[model samples]
Target: MLGVVPSSRAPNPFFWLEDTHTNTMEAIAMTIGHSTIPRMRVPALLKGNMIDVDLASLEGQWGMLCCLPRLEFCDAVFLNQFRRAVQKQGAALLGIQHPAHPFLAAHLPKAKILSIPLLTDSAQRIGRALGLSSETHLNQCQSFIFDPEGVVRNKLTHSFNWHCMTLLLGILKQCQ
Candidate 1:
């Protein structure tokens, strides 16, 4: 089991620890008002190239990480919307999907058209790390907002609708 210790820092109320004796990495359930995102690197596809992106290295700016089961036309549209919103706020936006997803190849062109980096988490490591796998829905859509210090400021999950987009935009505005 991973242990979470209270943090004195205002931005992050709690920090997590890994249990060394266990080979399996324990999932740390992130609470909107209580947890800081853990550091990790993930492979990303950008402009038709694969690269590794360090999540913790983005500590100097506001960033949003969106994880979807797969990429579709609707997902692309929402991603573009998020891209515009984040760019307006001078924040970074990233998307993640399982590499083996059935439609991933077909959606490559759409992803290439987008300016943001799209990550590939083949083993679902990122989702497991964020406790997203615990959700009832398999491969649920989720978005996370992290501040400059890498502390998660907000989290949205399940479906992505206009209302959700509006709420996310409002949160981004407030973050700024």
Candidate 2:
């Protein structure tokens, strides 16, 4: 019998799985990860207003996808700053967190994370599919930026910092 490792198995927290994969942030844009956007259209809660992000229709624009462990860690100030940065480059920023329905039901009222649009991945389907799932939780700081043609222009999966954010914004500027 061929034994297959379950993806739910915990990974070593000491190792940064996504960060160590390949340092492609400075590399030229490529089409190596060619999978088209997923077919599901999830709700994006933005400041009490709900919008549907049609992944299939975002064919000709720059976009960013972020996976965070929880919404509570996202403060209003950070959301504002992040949104301003994304807007400056004319890019769309979307986020995903676990148990989307409950999180939205409970915390959406506070309007804390109303800056960027977010999707709920209750089943971790999106996380597992995007290779952002880890032993304990989704890659909190992981992010991916895609070009108008839907090809990945930059991938940042490690810990996020000011320097890395500047680099991400730089890549977005180049995309524009």
Candidate 3:
């Protein structure tokens, strides 16, 4: 059985399950820990208006981008909490979903009401760049924390659970 271990590097609270024999897992862990957010243009809805924006423009500000399969009413509630937390730390929070996800379309009104920016990744370009895309889980939920310089300071895969949320908040505190 694998056990999770926290990295000794202070202020970087990323953790990985120990599995010395799994080179694939080690490689992924390394890639995520060191990779920076890629530059790309995508359509986004902010404050009820749709706009095309370049992701690189987000540099110089602490930001958290959460990629989820779909947005539900409950998920919206959670996002609201996350929004407040991010804002409290002087960071921006964004949510991304595949444009084809029906749930997000259904919740567009509520999504627009939220203060955070909601992005529509029509071509999965962001997903592919972040290595979160797959044939089966094209819209898997994940959370990424970026420093003002645009470096990926921390990331949570398969997120949205209570544990992940707690970890995310902790990471935000340390990063800020």
Candidate 4:
């Protein structure tokens, strides 16, 4: 993807994923990693406010789907990066973690951090949504980018890296 700078040379709405020469703060800050993406239902609980973020609210969002095991979502670096990237996309940052894990706090004081739980589809007869049937899945933190229409536009299955995020950013810019 090529960066689209107008004749005025102002940074356009799009960011190129392949351009390593022109590195910006936005590009530098984005992350590519396999931290557990806590899958959460919309309108979740945070502090005392009613945070509603479900597929309904997330329908028009270009969400990054993350899959993480228990106790791994609390990584400070991963959480912050995920939050920031999602914030930039103006999309819902989702994670699907195993049940019985802690809850993700919007802001934890010191040691109180929660993991986002993924939604379970009872229609198992149709297919395996998480793409995991056995308990021991190797690729845990695979990230998939879904467009505003809920169609997956990009996929990062192995690891998160600068190139991966740049690819995601490129897709996001196209979406915008």
Candidate 5:
């Protein structure tokens, strides 16, 4: 599936979408990050904790919404490179871990899991919201993109590929 539909509450995309065609291509690339995070709503799993990491504090900070396990696998090298990319730019990288794949911990430690215990409804809601209806082929998994202004910039329902990384990295470059 592609990215979620930019909520009506969010602003227009063209205005916020970076001009990735400029000569300074790298200068205007977007950073991969997280936004409109639903986890903020479910506090019971993490409620009233003033002594922990502040996910919201990462707002305005370059983000990368690293969705996990579409094909029951995640490349460690790719993940390392991804983290390295975002880290190099001093941007924040947030991992949107779902309940389906519980094995991400084997390789990732710093990743913050959103913990979506409920799967189907959340998956469909995200699919519709992101206008991923066209990507019927990628229905197997869910992952999307968002701009700094809360805009769902790009959507990916399929597994991570080299092209995906290039695109994600390009976004990260823009964020920097």
Candidate 6:
């Protein structure tokens, strides 16, 4: 499902139909992301202010879009190791957390010191788009890999751990 299309958009598999599609065709296209979609954007910010990261604008760089329940999910040590692992593969990690959590008050200062581009999603806008919610592991952490063209190459929704991180790294390698 991750890499397969249900049907060819055109008689030739390599050619996608353009211009002149009826309303029905357009409706069908809209349902594509129920499994996989073309783009995922990450608006990076820190401490309620924007941090200037435009993940969708990245041409050839891989992006790891991580959604955390609270700031504590990205503790200083974890951020350092996570950043190093991502950077080692020539990729970037972007994180999202609840904007008004108490943990932010205590841990965001340390995150700022680490220069992590942790974003605030008090309204759960991005989280919901990625299918995250309180019912899910009390807002368990999740991550998605966006390739250079902004397609979701892979995704993970689980409790975070070093072993999972290592497995993610391997998956990223395969995507590359």
lDDT of 1 by residue, 52-103 (tens): 8887888898888877666665667767777886788888888877434632
lDDT for 80 (candidate 4): 51
Query: Candidate 1 — which residues are off by over 4 angstroms?
Result: 1-33, 98-103, 134-140
Number of the top-ranking candidate, with lDDT as the measure:
3
TM-score for each model: 0.67, 0.64, 0.69, 0.48, 0.44, 0.62
Q: Pick the candidate with the highest TM-score.
A: 3
Instruction: Name model 5 segments beyond 4 Å from true.
Output: 1-35, 38-53, 70-74, 103-142, 147-152, 174-176
Q: Please, what are the lDDT tens digits per residue for candidate 4 over residues 1-176?
A: 34533333324332323343665322211223233222334444333233555554566667766544433333434555656766776876655443334544445542234323233333332114434333424333455666666666544442344455445555566656
Ranked by TM-score, the better of candidates 5 and 6 is: 6
**Which residue runs of candidate 4 sit more than 4 Å off their true CA positions?**
1-53, 73-77, 98-111, 114-127, 130-139, 160-176
TM-score winner between candidates 1 and 6: 1
lDDT of 6 by residue, 31-138 (tens): 112322223454555643555555446657886766665555356468668889899998877776643453354245555554567765556666666554444345
Clashes of each: 0, 0, 0, 16, 20, 0
CA lDDT for candidate 6: 0.56
Model 6, position 172: C-alpha lDDT score: 79
- Global lDDT for candidate 5? 0.40
Error of 1 at 117 (Å): 1.5
Off by over 4 Å in 2: 1-32, 98-113, 136-140, 174-176
Backbone clashes (count) for model 1: 0
The window of 10 residues in a row where model 2 has the poorest summed lDDT is 23-32
- lDDT, each prediction: 0.64, 0.58, 0.66, 0.45, 0.40, 0.56
